[model samples]
Target: MVIVSVVGGISLLLLVFLWSIKRGQKTVRAFVFLSAVADGNSVESANELAKRIDLFAASELQKKAMIMVEMVFGGSQLKLISHARREGFDQ
Candidate 1:
């Protein structure tokens, strides 16, 4: 009984961890858009946005993939802007 309970608890925790990562990526994307607004984005609003996105995620793997995509590609708007600030792009 003890071993079974321990395994169940660990499994639940793992699920939560994956969900949080997916939710965090949604927060980042929302923040990027909110930053475009004249007023600054609030932490509360960002958290709410994350919750909505988490609920909308189709599956654990899909959620994880979305987060990875946002990090590597979707969030490059700022990186490109910063790179453009520098001098000519020559190798």
Candidate 2:
């Protein structure tokens, strides 16, 4: 009975560990999708994204995605300002 209980406890811990890893992967995938959208390019398929995600650390992937988003936002803001200037809105 003691052996069975030990095995069951270990199994539970292993399952929890696997769950956390899967959750982290989903978070990374979401970040990658956001970056892809911000860049206005074709979004990667799930398998492609999963493969790419596996290549980098989760934190690294998140950081790169955020930088991509920031750049896209910055560029769009500049373009808006340029358009406003062309329309003489500043005056």
Candidate 3:
């Protein structure tokens, strides 16, 4: 019985770890998508991208993406806001 319980616990932990890795992959994909959109230099495109990002589950990747976006766009708040509203961000 003890061995069975131990194995069950380890299996649960393994499942949780795999789930976390999957979530991280999603975040990375979103970040890459954001980079591609930002490179286009179109506010409309960015806004559309923002809409897509909103569909993602909340995560730290969103904050990192914002920082990267600001740097890419020359750190201008006006430009960022104009292109992508910070409201309801997932990126």
Task: List the candidate numbers ranked by lDDT, top first.
Answer: 3, 2, 1
Candidate 3 lDDT over 1-91, as tens digits, reads 9999999999999999988665444444445444555586354555455445432533546577557546766754344443433432244
Worst 10 residues of 3 by lDDT: 81-90
Local distance difference test, candidate 3? 0.53
How does model 1 score by TM-score? 0.38
By lDDT, is 1 or 3 better?
3
Model 1: number of clashes?
0
What lDDT does candidate 2 reach at residue 58? 67
How many steric overlaps are in each model, in order?
0, 0, 0
Residue pairs of candidate 3 with colliding backbone atoms: none
Best model number under TM-score: 2
**Model-by-model lDDT, in order?**
0.46, 0.52, 0.53
Q: Judged by TM-score relative to the true structure, which candidate is superior, 1 or 2?
A: 2
RMSD of each: 10.8, 13.4, 9.0
Q: How much is the lDDT of residue 37 in candidate 3?
A: 59
TM-score of 2: 0.54
lDDT per residue as tens, model 2, 1-91:
9999999999999999988666555545555544444455444443354346663566567555445435654524334334323433221
How far is 58's C-alpha from truth in model 2 (Å)? Answer: 2.5
